[model samples]
Target: AAAVGATKQELTLSIAIVSLFSLLFLLAEPYAAMGLGLSDDVAGAWIGGTVDLTGGVVAGAAVVSARCEEVAAIIKMTQNSALGVYILLIAVLASRSGLGGKDAASPAPPAKGEGLVYGLWKKFPKFVLGYLFCSVVASSLADRERGIAVPLLGGVARWWFAIGFSGLGFSTSFRSLREQLDGPNVLVHY
Candidate 1:
């Protein structure tokens, strides 16, 4: 939605809210898990599954145990697999709504026999395939010789995601971000 300029402020607010919630979850998960008498693995899975950020999930689980972090990362990857489907759904809806580049005044509902397959193909999150492939390979290797592959795969995945995030940070317009931060809307939203 933010990419297409649909409710940009709302998207920003959603991001902020999720970030805040993830931080809160990280802080609270351990005590809550202990109170509930949950095992470290279960607690980590719950944290990873619920939190919006993979880093937060990994960090949260790491605070519990290395074994927990491993479980958490895998759960996070599994959860992320659904993102492609979500994006596809969004693309279909957006195409029907004449979003992405079309004039809003004119509706561009798919023509008489136009199938959504093409639009979905165009909008699919292609990185998800790479993620899934890496996950499958990692899982296969992890089941072999003393499970040595888990840490190696996880360390690589962490750096890959970190680099991707760094790219995003580098690409972001600081001036635009400052303007957004300065607005009364930010206060009201908060």
Candidate 2:
């Protein structure tokens, strides 16, 4: 979002849209997959592809079956690998379009031979590598170890998410939310 020069309002809008999409996809995919006589793994993968969050994907898959959870995790992780590329593309487009502000235009364009690969490297999401590394380590563990590790890691993730959310809530001023709520179109938009 920072690379794209999105304001707080745009980030809020993005979150709202993501929430709506996650809800609709979570509710709709299972039944649709069942109607088509798809297996749980396939249905889970479908849900994984649609949902961006790992926890949400796992929850949606678990609604169908326990095995679906594992399948969904793998699929979601695979899907998430593309996020770096997605962000890089967005950054490049933002730069080209001057969406990142006037400073973006001050730099000369890369040589023709330099191409997108060079630019993409500069904007790539490094966190993805960490995710991939953890995934590899988890996969390499013994079944018993993995059984223990999964829940432990999940609990830690939930704690971190809670802390992050609390920080965000603390940082946001109620006055700003109230002002947005006061807008005549807020209700209609919601």
Scored by TM-score, the top model is 2
Where does candidate 1 stray beyond 4 Å?
A: 1-17, 35-42, 65-74, 102-115, 135-156, 171-190
Residues 1-190, model 1: lDDT tens digits:
4223244344444456566678888888856876888887898788878878877888888877887788889999877877767766776777766565244322344455666675444444467678678767766663664278677867887898889757655655546655666464544544
Q: Candidate 2 at residue 188, lDDT?
A: 56
Tens digit of lDDT per residue, candidate 2, span 105-159? 2233344576655544443446566666777988999999999998998788689
TM-score of each: 0.59, 0.61
Worst 10 residues of 1 by lDDT: 101-110
List clashing residue pairs in candidate 1.
Answer: none
